[model samples]
Target: MKPSNGSTVSQQSALSTPSGPSSASASAPLAEDDPEPRPAVAALPRHVFSENEAEPEEGRTGDTPTLVFGVPASDEPGFREELLLPTYEALRRAFPDHRIEWREMSKFDLILAVVKREVDLYVVSSGFFAYLTHGAGSSWLATRKIPQASDPEHAVGGLVVARAADDRYATIADLRTARAAAASSQSFPSWTAVLGEIANVTSYPEHFLGKPRFTGDSGLSVVERVLRKETDVGFLRTCEYETLVARGLVHPQALKVVGERTSEALACRTSTELYPDLVLAARPDLSDSVRRRAAAAVFLIPESASGYAWTVANDFRSVRRLVARFGSAPSEHAEPSAALDRYKYALVISVLLLGGAILYSVSVSGVVARRTKELVAVIDEKTTLEQTARVSRERLSQLERAGIVSELSSMIAHELRQPVAGLVNYADGLALYLSGKQDPVVEEATREIARQAERVSSIVERVRAYAKGKSDVRQPSDLCVVAKRAFTTFRSGADLTGVRVSGEFLPEAPVSGDPLELELLVVNCLKNALHAAKSSPDGHGEIRIRVSDDASGEKWCLEVEDNGPRIDDAKFAELSHPVTSEKFEGLGLGLSISRVIAERHAARLLFRRAGERGLVVTLLIAKRPVEAEDASHGTGGMNGMDGTLAAPKAVPASHYGADPSRNVLSDE
Candidate 1:
């Protein structure tokens, strides 16, 4: 599910940034409602959608392989600057439960970076992609050129220009003598599709005005130079052009629109026929699954209106056609390498095959004979390791049993006695004061004793299952009952100190997880969510939890999403890979242990990402029936597939759902 439009960043803020400094005065002030720009996201977590519901539009009838992408820098100045960044950011923000990473490098370096077994994806300009696939690029990608993720034929190219002017160069012919610049001559829609064609008509100055001038230094530089009149023109895709115009870099009338092209109505304009821009290309040798995932990511981008939506998914044929026609644009890849590769395989093969036949056979036989002994050693070692694992499992099981028992006992004491103790202390102290001091002081003390007694009772009531160390529990429970119970159980004195638990749930939606454990999970998730949100740039951020299922079968996903700073891909990977931080407190055990519990129920654990901000942690539990056990709410009449189960619809107010807003906070 998507967050509220405000929390997610309104299109207005994104569309209205002033490019030049002076425009601030003439430009409207920041929204009155928004004294300071709202933090990217709110601090509260909203689960308007429950974990046991289907995602808004993800109809998962089948499975797709995972795909990887390799890109250069993060967002940059202009046209070419952040093309992949937002796409990457949006992907992370929207689909927080997938695997994606950026291998950071200049787009120009992708020519050498993409090999049969190298990166699974390369997000370069369409023109740059054309150069690689011209020949063996097929060997680099596959037998033929293909669209990165989408179907190529459906993809369109874009044209970036200074906004159109009433009195301006009317056509490419008119601008034939104009000095136009671009982020790169090799940029997809910019130079390759737009200005490069213009170059054929324009007379080349011996220098960029006087020296070798190129806008490819950065996308924004081109726009900047054009605005400064250093270059007469600049090019960008419609989306990018909109971004610049929004940012106030160039006015709509600052430059002339020499051309405009479109693939659909109400679509962003382009200078040339639209061709695939950022593609999810596979390393010539990626597995089928990887390729599929890569494609899905691209296709799904545009699903949510506010999601990082792509216009279309393209196929290989049309993409190849464009690559063939455009050929290679001017690029820096032609430069010679400073380092040389050495080949030692030939020498080794010659020595092994020719000179050492007889001698090598004798040596090989001896080595093989010795290896038979080594195999024995390896098998023995493996057996020992297995044995150790068994012993460790036993010990760990004992420890878990002990921990649970101990924790339960502590909870009981803590719940039943703490408030009682407080009451006793207050009463005793007051009795002494009343006898020896005054009536008013005794009355005040008596009130405190009553308050303490009530507080203790509240704890005892919520922790019934925890105190008993049993899974048994009865329920006529509604969503509010469960939430309030959990909240009271883990009550913290300060609202800000603990997590703000705020998502809504459908009470009528039947769910099967153990109510006690489920409550525990929610509380734990709330605790973590609050901590994580507070640690983020959007101090008080929003966490969205949603549940739904479609063609992929029933799934219950709890997403603790935050647009806080994103963890580095490397660190994120480590956490996901069953990593252990020996002395790490709070975060380490929580995620690792929670993951174990989720998997036991045939659920998945995932961490979502944002652009260098916040983390979205999700527990995706399949709704299929469990073969081993029945669901907890057996009478809810939920149908089961395998051992997992799903109700006809979420229990009213008990089944959870959520979406977030910008600055403003709402309970429902």
Candidate 2:
């Protein structure tokens, strides 16, 4: 998942990067010499693995428990075909007392299946497994030990490549403006790994990579994109690249590896240090016995065309950290370190001078000799660049933290200005009234002074709470009362013409959470909606809030709808993430904080495009069961048997899984 800076030492390039057959065959890679690829999975009966032809008779008398194995569908049609549609006989022999069923799914669906207990185990890449572990609490049961030719260990690396003729891409620094072709966004080698490497060396990694085009689902697609010049650079897992070359699908000299690094212990060329390979992880509820039995059977699977055998899982902390670095939200105040900027200018000059010398030499020598010389030059330059990048990375980390603090200080000062000014004005008015002997005006000024003081106190409290990462004091309360109070507070601030704000609340909506926090969440959403409606092209808008039970009848839904400009898909995807906003004012932390509050309440916060005109944000909360004592107090905490509010359980990913097409946050 994460890329590495491995050392690249000079040698006969040919010796370091072998142009030989895969370990599987000397003739060709995965050709007719190998077994025919399994047929594609199609419509199947519910219990596809029920056939008992290969099941042992001794275990037939007992009740049969079914275990479902899930496999995420890959773009390479044949990659997962054999694994998913393995001969039923093999599964029967391996799991004789149990029925084995296979489920092919998309990534999102696969995660949901695990969360909802639809599948017992799933085979996934290390990067995706890390994502599940962080986002859904899934854990690994076992990992596959691929062939030495495939990985040499439980880990695998990735290769970043460019056309052999393109001389500009000599190092990671030279890849600044290059368009990249990657596999799926979730892919470790082709996407996450490449991103991690670039991010280490650059301040704005997104701009450096120039918006990569997701080619397809396989490593071969990356090669094809590079060869066709659809992308300036390409990324692939090391083994996949070598296998393609061995099959003659790609020419050995057609492409040059970027950041090419050689390790004596590594069997293949790589641009990144190896990370843990694919793994078989289990759902949270899978029994230890079943997990052990499954792991044992998978280890017994002899090496086949897939070039893998199951092995004990290695520590995947490195891969998890790698993903965390890339997925981390960018600091709004971040800038390139001064040291890096200085080095970059120096690097550019050196590259230009070296290129000029190489061009002159090429003119004297024949093309063949020039090509070999250029290869050596590139290798040497990349090694130097890597060292420079390492230094820059160290400086960048220190400077980044300082920049964020400075930016936050400036924002806090800006926020304090309004209330401070109001307080001064109130003080001046009171002084004038007292000097003029106007008692009535002095009384009014005193009240105004109290209000301004409270406003300042409130602002300071908010800043302190955010700094300390504190959650609100929670209790069982009525959702409708919180919504109404929040609506009233928001209405007091909204001074717009031709904008109608309306709310339809159900009679009773009991929820177990902080009332103040719930009110704040509602206020923030309403405030954001008002801003959107004000910016409507038509200059007229309607914002509506409705409280009712969701279609599922299990959760209470708070839907906020607005008639404003439709947010572009790209911006919509990042709504819940903190960033500087172009349309809304302040620190751009409102929606992000709202998401946090939603999480604390064990609710789902979703944003979706409402038809062709505006956006709709829905908050789905688990309905709280009301007790007899709850009705006694109009707005007090729930009095359950424990004399405290029931702790909220987080809604499973299954809640969002039902219809992702309608919920943008669900995809994230």
Candidate 3:
């Protein structure tokens, strides 16, 4: 009787088959009431071992060995059970005392079980068997025989299938850009075998099929997708199309095999070189006697019982080669080992060269460090030389300014003498007229007028003396009073038509300077502002004069601003020093002299372009303490001379239109 569960069968019934009544036949007599006495059931036969065939060690121990057979879980539904049933039944008949157990697991788990010796034997694809033989030390017992194939070893391969109606893919190469489907990426016959064939024809086998979709576990789905136009091509196991057609699961005319190869030994249409079929392999640790018996039992299976037979295929060289080419071979490490051995000398030479490069880098770094230090010393020397040159330039500039001042002094003195004489004549006439009238207010005003005329003469004489290198004393004076006086004087002399002039003055803004020179500087700035304002496009202009002290009381400012045509920043920057005047009918001496007087008072002259239009000229000076003026009265002033100012430094010759060759100062 066949095993009910297909996993285990009792040895008693297996041994008693055909020799005695079955249990059903014997039990039927027990249920009968008719008294025709049944002849006694034939006694079950006992087998005896020959002298050369010793009893199994398990039989001696009275414990049956359960032979576990493992199959891949990825096999099609019912394929595992059907494939192994014949072998299971054959093993039961051959060893009546042994037990048989069947197991289904993934290919990876099945390999692990075999390697761990958890399963005594396993049946897996030839590709997996090749791995087991080399990696897990499994011994091949038999290779499955294709019933119609003349050669068992050349029985299996992959098929590239496409819809018969689809003329787009007639061959494997034509399917490169076509949408392709496969059973699984891990399926050997469905994917790897096809890939191997493509690898033979092209260097890039992975991309030959373009990106194929993997339908789960069975190639039938891949065929269905191809027929439904879901995919243009499908990869299937060899004979899978024919098997589906025979089973009525597929219409034979619906799909065609691509790149089909014909072999007298193989009956199926295959696109790849035929390799060995599924293998029954024994674990390395399985007993030799049991392994031999199992192999014999597998060989004894009648082909009629399972429609397939097991045969010993000594040549799995083709399968092994495919596994190696696909990089799934257990001996994959051998390739890298051989490469390393071949290049060992070159590797050593490269190491030596790298070491030399590192040493050279270290030496070069040392040289760079030494060179950097030398460069730093050279830079320091350059800086020191630049400083010396700057000092010499300043001294030379001072001499040039003095020479220019000396050259202009006579002309300046001549111009001022006439103004001074006119003032004196007017003052005398006013005094004479007042003497006759004897009005007290008029007499005081005439005396004040004469004093003012005397002060003008004194100022012109002092300017000429200063040009000749005489030191005039500086005294604490209210800058606000000076600026107010300059503004009043400018307003009196200049045309006031179409121009508005205003002043913002502090009550007291004290600074140490020659008061006459300070007033002259303010007057010059006011004159320039008035000129700029009058040059406005509209002919109507405004000028504002401001005299203020900082909150610290240590500095004071005189600012004169005008609304006129906007001066470019470059031109305004040039105004910081006295440059040639851009105006018509004007000498640039006005600003040059103003700058000199400002320098003598230790003040800075700054020119800035006002927003939208015009220029703002500012004189920034350090404020002098009130006590210093009293101290100065007891002693000499800045030049240690009473009532005289210190001689000014020479200005750059560039400012005075002197010979450029003699100007040593850089514009910077």
Candidate 4:
């Protein structure tokens, strides 16, 4: 076996058991000498084998398998060797025909030997054995029972020690700034266990104990360093100090245990929780029969002088928890530095991916905002075009309707002109016959008949000129005179049993329009009002004609109001066009013709709701100045009329015969 630092591997033959009478004395001479004297053995258990022990049933043969036992070399001379001597002697006695070899190596190398299948069985720390069981599929065989331990499973723990003379360091807190020493970083009880305990107290265990110095492969060196003041505190396996004191190597009062714990089943002074001690485990590939035989041989070995025996340990959970708390278990595959390098690469890639995602999101947001803005502008343009198209359609329809009405009017006037002339001639002859008779009522009736016949002739001429598209002769006209005359005619012609008519007129409200056309406009308004009022559900209705000038004296308004069922906005809008009439005998041209006449005079025809149950029709025309009467006389008359300007005929107010209480006619 070669020696490296304090670790060495020694291969020994199990058949080379000592022939001496005492096993302790026999095992003492097997240890290799060192510069420092080794501690004397305390006591040795009785040897497990006798000279007449049973041999294996199968005799020694060339095909006999050799059992390789792996053991970790310790820094302390002869410590592990002497402890395992009896088991070697017992195995040699049990399998006399088979060969047994002892192979010693460092703890790390021994674990590798087991993993590589080079060693059939091995001795390992409880914590490392748990790691092997999980990571390497190693199987448990037995656990070493510690001397004076109440429970074999609770035999191992770590110790924190300070110089007894140093009063400044007594508890674990006192060692926070103290330099720490240990047997080896790989030693579980001396190093890992203590670190795990300190980890429980502080998040940074490295800062808690400062930095630990690993002396050698033995806890004895750790104790020596503490005595020399090279380290303020020393970490050791449980009972290591007591074992040294028993060997008379160190004084009992030389050092003190920091934060020592007392346990009912544990006799050792420990600074951490107890776990199972050394375990004997078999490689998974080993034969079951061979494994059972090896375990039986381990159980046969008597307890050592230092109180070491083997028994099955059902639980190693405490050891497993300790290893897990310290982060990772010992592995032969990778080092810590290599794993850290992989982590660095992963972090850089993650950051790059995150930055790219943010940039992508911002770009997408900008694109969506621009798209939304463009869509809104398109929508607004579409709405404006739609409105323009609708207005154009309405104007085209009105022109078509007007053209049709014009043709119809021309035909009707042509057909009626001769008949109207014949009626006028007949009325004239009758008036001549009745003039001298002087029956007052008959005379007045005859005059009315002539007047009406002449009115019909004038209306036909106006319609014929409109059909010919000839401009009418505009003249200075009083809207009040036109309104009063139209209202008087409407009252006389229409049934008025339950109907009332009234007029409110601005006496000289003036506007520039053809007098005949103005009269036609007022007459159409009164006709519509009377029809609306008579349609009322109560069969009682009122009509009022109002002519007034605006405050600015710029426009004259002729308003016809009636207490009738009102029309909704949609129905009223239809009134401006030649829509189907609501009345049974109506031709639906009254309002439309009125609108055309008002437009000819550059005026507006409007209709509105009056209160909750009425309709009001208004004609707004530009006011005429007094001087415009002479200005109009200078212009010639209409196309078919003579070149003379006919003065507006005057009608007596008494001819209206309006009832003072009901049919009121006011000249305001």
Q: Pick the candidate with the highest TM-score.
A: 3
**lDDT of each structure?**
0.48, 0.64, 0.68, 0.70
Best lDDT among the predictions, by candidate number:
4
Ten residues in a row with the worst lDDT in model 2?
A: 1-10
Better-scoring candidate (lDDT), 1 or 4: 4
User: What tens-digit string does per-residue lDDT give for candidate 4 at 1-668?
Assistant: 32111123345433223344353333332111223333332222222211222233344445556677787765342345555656666666666656666666777787667656678878889887776665556788898887658798888889998888788877676778788998777778887788778777788776787778987556667766777777889898987777666544566677888988888778868998888888888888888887888889888777667666788775977777766656344446534443355357877888899999999999999999999999999999999999788767866776677678888888888888899888878888988898888899987877777777777777788788776767555666667666766766666677775678778665466677777777777887877777888877677888888777766668888788988887887887777665556878876667677887888899998888888888888888998776786566543333213212233333555566543334358321
- Candidate 2 is scored at a TM of 0.39
Better of 1 and 3 by lDDT: 3
Superposition TM-score, candidate 3 onto the true structure: 0.58
lDDT of 2: 0.64
Clashes found in each candidate (C-alpha, N, C closer than 3 A) = 88, 0, 6, 2
- 522-555, model 2: which lDDT tens digit per residue? 9888888888888888988788887888999989
Ranking by lDDT: 4, 3, 2, 1
**Model 1: per-residue Cα lDDT over 1-668, one tens digit each:** 23311112112222223445565422322221222322211211111211132222353322322234566542333322224445556545444444344455655565556633245666655455555555434222211112221333434454645434324555555554466676654556655556344544555412222232465454445655655556566666545554444544334555555665545522555566555545445555555664555455555443332222344434445455545555453223443221111124656686778777878789999999999999999999999999889768855764576577557766676666665666667776766667755677667767556555654544454345344654332322222333433444444432454234454333322334544445555566656665566666645555544433423556655555655456677677665643344233642455555665565455677776755677767766554345323524444543211112233243322222222221112232
Ten contiguous residues with the weakest lDDT in model 1: 40-49
Model 3: colliding residue pairs: 73-105, 398-650, 472-644, 472-645, 473-644, 473-645
Sliding window of 10 residues with minimal summed lDDT for model 4: 44-53
Q: Estimate each model's TM-score.
A: 0.33, 0.39, 0.58, 0.43
In candidate 2, the residue pairs with backbone N, CA or C atoms under 3 Å apart (3 or more residues apart, or in different chains) clash, namely none
